[model samples]
Target: MTASTLSAHHVGITVNDLEELLAFYRDVLGLTVVDRFAVGGDAFADAVGVEEGRAEFAHLEAGGIRIELVEYDPEARGSPAAGLNQPGATHVGLAVDDLEAFYADLPESVSTISEPRTTESGTSILFLRDPESNLIEVLES
Candidate 1:
């Protein structure tokens, strides 16, 4: 039997601070906010493997891709290793038209691993951390 696999639904990032993450993704990164909702009660707790769980979710869209940012009341926090070589390390990749311009305008609150580096293939890549310290890989080709 053929394996059933559909296209990705969305990329979900668990965050401790919802407001700050929203501002970074929406205002700084220029993603559009599509929806916002709050979930809790029995079903939520069961699905999350927690005795009690409540969360606020914000959905943002960029380049036709959806990014779901969620904040839990109990505050689930984890940082994938500082380097990308670690197992289970994950990051969201984004593309920009002008990486230099974007970097120049970045606020001090934003943390960048380094300035954009252009590979021999003429593709520029940058690594940045969100307010929650989640990694985001940005490229311009």
Candidate 2:
């Protein structure tokens, strides 16, 4: 028997600084800003399961997926690393057409934990830490 697999729609991440995030994801990494909305209005709050208030968010499209960058009023802090040995919280993997050029374009904002290298699978990949300390995988497939 065959069953359908779940498809990921979008991933929402809370950010304290929208400007920094936008610069990293949009300017540095080159994700397209598809849309944006200010969090307010009871309808919008209810829909997203949050209390009504003046929050702000940006919808970014990267590699055919949606990334919601939210700045909630009374902003929330990002999670601490799960553990040094374990993979840090959630990571978003991005496919780069040109790994070298991409690495060259990265701003000082994102720290390169490891430089670009080839995996056993012959995949060229690298790890980066975002401003919020979230791990990001840049791979060439």
Candidate 3:
């Protein structure tokens, strides 16, 4: 596509556990796995900004949102996930008809920042971290 024809693409998240994260998205979140592939070598490393990086990647999509999961070389894993307030960090937001019910149904392993609360705008919202500490926002639809 030309520069003037640019459009939105997928959001990429580097993960420590590809399989687990893949399962979380595909099973728990109900996203469909669209593609899976592996890449490595100098070109791959240069393109991904990881030195000597080889990675397995999966693309998942549903409800018009697409996500790309990348697992870097096993021996050279990255650091802990960044907090939401940290620069350059991004979080995913989702809507549910019943925020309280959704929060209650979440697996015990999922850690939330706090109980669901009503914001100034009157939207019931909650924040939870995924297995890998990636922040997610859940709001009442």
What local distance difference test score does each model get? Answer: 0.89, 0.80, 0.85
Q: Candidate 2: where is the Cα deviation over 4 Å?
A: 1-6, 41-54, 82-88
* Candidate 3 local Cα displacement, residue 111, angstroms: 0.8
Question: What alpha-carbon RMSD in Å does predicted model 2 have with respect to the real structure?
Answer: 3.5
Taking the tens digit of each residue's C-alpha lDDT, what string does model 1 give over 1-141? Answer: 769978988999888889999999999899999999999999999999867889999999979789999988877555667677889888889989999998999998899999999989888999999977889999984
Query: Would you list the rank order by TM-score, best first?
Result: 1, 3, 2
TM-score of each: 0.89, 0.78, 0.84
Tens digit of per-residue lDDT, candidate 3, span 60-95: 985677889988894464565478777777888877
Best by TM-score: 1
Candidate number with the higher lDDT (1 or 3): 1
lDDT of 1 at 11: 95
RMSD of 3: 2.5
Off by more than 4 A, model 1: 1-5, 77-79
After the best TM-score superposition of candidate 3, give how far the Cα of residue 122 lies from its true spot, in angstroms.
2.2
Query: TM-score: which is higher, 1 or 2?
Result: 1
**Per-residue C-alpha lDDT of model 2 across residues 27-116, encoded as one tens digit per residue:** 777899998888578887777666654578898998789988888875555576743357645777889888888888777667887789
User: What count of clashes does model 1 give?
Assistant: 0
User: What's the lDDT of the predicted structure labeled candidate 2?
Assistant: 0.80
